[model samples]
Target: MRTIESYLRMLLIMTLCYLIAEWVIDEPKGTVLFNPYVLGFLFFIFLLVISFEVIIGVLERIADQLTTPEQRVALEEAKKQKALENKWKKRFAEWLIGKQTTPEAQLILEDHNYDGIRELDNPLPPWWLYLFYLTLIFGVVYLGYYHLFGGSDQKQNFEQEMAMAKEQIETYKKTAASFVDETNVTVLTDASSLESGKSLFEIHCAICHQNDGGGAIGPNLTDNYWILGGDIKSIFLTIAKGGRPGKGMIAWNNSLKPQEIQQLSSFILSLNGTTPQNPKAPEGTLINQ
Candidate 1:
């Protein structure tokens, strides 16, 4: 019995340590025995348990060798005394189970006999009765908290969470306009987009290209001639990445949102064929006259 108890205690300690390790390590893929850290922890636990058992076995052997016959008799007497001291614990266990009637004392019901087999009146177990009572109390509490009171139901909670999630998605959409790059960019010709683009151009690009995009320090945007290319994509890239290396126009990618850039690009394209106050001499290859 002692050996079995020792083994059970060691197993319990190992199980508790394993649970602690699992709680500490929050692995998204889920922890497994094969995981290096988990495997190492288990190995260490195994070694510790084995060492403990080995030490206990050696101590027991040493005690046996050192003990005299008279001491052995005294140890047996002490064990009996210890058992006597714990007699109440055994009685308490029996009390919880309730007293069972012996075969001789059992009352047989002759009226309930079926096929020559008589029925004995057996009471329900005390532990099971206690558990049933607890369940009844729990059910009452549950009903009072959720049904009687104004506690939100599962459906209401779900709807509220979904509403919050929907709001978050909407917010992300508004902010994610800046996530646009050269590949997915398209020309926006709406009045509002053009106005916004014009505003941005006046603030930033107007310094080099002049207010009318007729060219000052930069090449003329009103003309069809483009130093790079005349296409919308080419213009967008030029605006985002800048005119050329060591040249006048600096990259506006850091300063402007992609949506804003798209707007500016659209407004710049709208200037094609339109007259400027003082057009600079065409400096690049003309794609369209």
Candidate 2:
């Protein structure tokens, strides 16, 4: 029960941290609430916090197992004695310096006396020197990792990713043409094809044509009037060829398979007479029902 409670608490903390991080990063953008980068960063921060808590908790548990109450008391007493000895040593050193008039002590002191100013040359603390050395070691490790695997250089990573994507796209195009042959493409009016077409349209086309086929960048498909044509073949041809030059619709012949195009044409035909908000003014010949 305690373990379950801990897990639940951790989950709640992580959720709260994510919400806070998301809110902080998304403060500038008021219109759209969901930002992928913000969400990713929030998730990363939550994971980091969880990792830190787990590591510390594990270390504490290990420490508890290693040290008994008696051992802890002994350790504390030893630390106290060491601190007292250090304090006495400092006081003795100060007293000895006050009484120092020897040639060695005089030589150690500088003679640039102004009012009551004195300077002493002290060696760097051993702990500070060790810390400096550790910092240099850390720097070397960071540099090696970043150069080898992290790809800290943004331009290089961007170019590499772009190259990879381009290669993949080329391979896809080569395989795609076999399935999207223009000559062998047949019109689809079947229910299964129409459903597939609807799914594809929702994922790829809805951004421009909208969910209800109300046009934003593309023409409305629901009304009888069409921009290119209302007939299935003409619609398929227009989709294959794209809109008139410079009208923003690119030839989807490369992106979509021939059968998929037929399905999309069927789906468009299925949308006839469906109502949508802000439909564009009728532009093509009105196909009589």
Predicted model with the maximum TM-score: 1
The models' CA-based lDDT, in order, is 0.82, 0.74
TM-score result, candidate 1: 0.40
Lowest summed lDDT window (length 10), candidate 2: 92-101
- Tens-place lDDT digits, model 1, residues 1-289: 3564577678898888777777777764345555887888888988998899889989988998899999999998998898689888546544556555678648544467688888766665677788889999999998998989968989999999999999997777668865666766787888999999999999998888888989888999999899988788888899899988888788889988888889999999988898888888887898874
Superposition error at 41 for model 2 (Å): 50
User: What TM-score would each prediction reach against the true structure?
Assistant: 0.40, 0.36
State which candidate has the highest lDDT. 1
Which sections of candidate 1 miss by over 4 Å?
A: 1-179
- Report residue 115 deviation for candidate 2 (angstroms): 99
What's the lDDT for residue 47 in model 2?
78
Off by over 4 Å in 2: 1-187
